[model samples]
Target: MTDLTEHEVLVRPRAAPEAPAGRTTGWWAMVLFISTEAATFAAILASDFYLRFSAKGSWPPTSEKEPDLVLPTTATVIILVSCLPMLLGSLAAARGSRAGGLLGTLGAFAGGVAFLVLQIVDWLSEWPDSTVSKDAYGSLFYAITGLHAAHVLIGVGMLAFLLVSLAVRRAAARPRGPVSLVAMYWYFMGVVAVAVYVTVYLSATLWATR
Candidate 1:
């Protein structure tokens, strides 16, 4: 005869799962920050268009010339290309590979520095005669591109800080959030850089030359 036991259970009792920590707040904060930045950039771009179309005859005036495209085009490519390494670094951090993460960040920083150097050279060569104080064209051109360049600088700084943190192994405990935020900011800056290139260089040159 089999004895029926009230305490007989096929499986052991398991502890209750821990509640997920609320992570949405950080993500929403980042989104809000980017949105505000985007709006400010939109206003600046709008002002650029308004000034461009409102000007008499050709934009850039006859005396001022369209900026040389070769260098600026190269810089745009470099800046956008850096997004790849930035992505890699973020992924590596999330995976908890300190070496891979550091290497990726360094690669991105190199690319960013190269882009900035090219920009400085291009500005010196192309805009030697053009000054922001000279006219609306110069002012808008400098304002838009300068703002974008500053964003790149900030992105690079973020990566540098991430690198330092990784070097110290501080992110081992929880690396996802900080790295993810930096990746988002980098991507936003890259997209905005493309827009700036199109507005300040491409459209302006095409319209001014026509």
Candidate 2:
């Protein structure tokens, strides 16, 4: 030990790992996107109310009866129920529990598919000329509900892709971020569907039914 105190080793501390970019940015982007979409639906709803109230005598114009509430109400229940599974999946992912996430995600996806099928069947059913070209009632009805249905379909596809990525474990090792964004979108879709159901089905039935 010859002058060991004077010849001390200087160890450089290891640098901390840099966080990946777009971690919170992705969530912000989705929030903005959904804001714009909500605005669009709001405008459409306003226009519908304006047209319905402005027209003289009979909001649906006598030709078109109020839409069947049973089908759409049923679909609403299904979609709303789907949110539970989606919430479960998001929670599981946050805790890094892959098996729980997988089961919940699969359940949510199946519920979404069922909703779409039921909506399509409702659209096909003959309920006193429920086509877009039929009248103002048909046009607004299709526009609002169709827009919502499209969103639901997109959400389902996103879930499918996420489910695949999670299964492989090649990427998305920590899926909390992506799963949270998807959950946000799914919940938004459900809320919009309920609004549409109220405006298109409940209101019409109460006030415009022949």
Report the number of the highest-TM-score candidate: 2
The TM-score that candidate 2 achieves is 0.88
lDDT of each: 0.82, 0.84
Give a tens-digit lDDT track for model 2, residues 1-210.
Answer: 554343353453557999877548888899999999999999998888899888888876678765777789889999999999889988998998776677677877988898999898888883547678887888998888899899999999988987897788742587787778888999998899888998887887777745
| TM-score on alpha carbons, each prediction | 0.86, 0.88
Model 2 stretches with alpha carbons more than 4 Å out? 1-13, 18-23
What residue pairs clash in candidate 1, if any at all? none
Question: Model 1 compared with the native: what TM-score?
Answer: 0.86
List, residue by residue over 44-80, the lDDT tens digit for candidate 1.
9999999888899788777776777888899888878
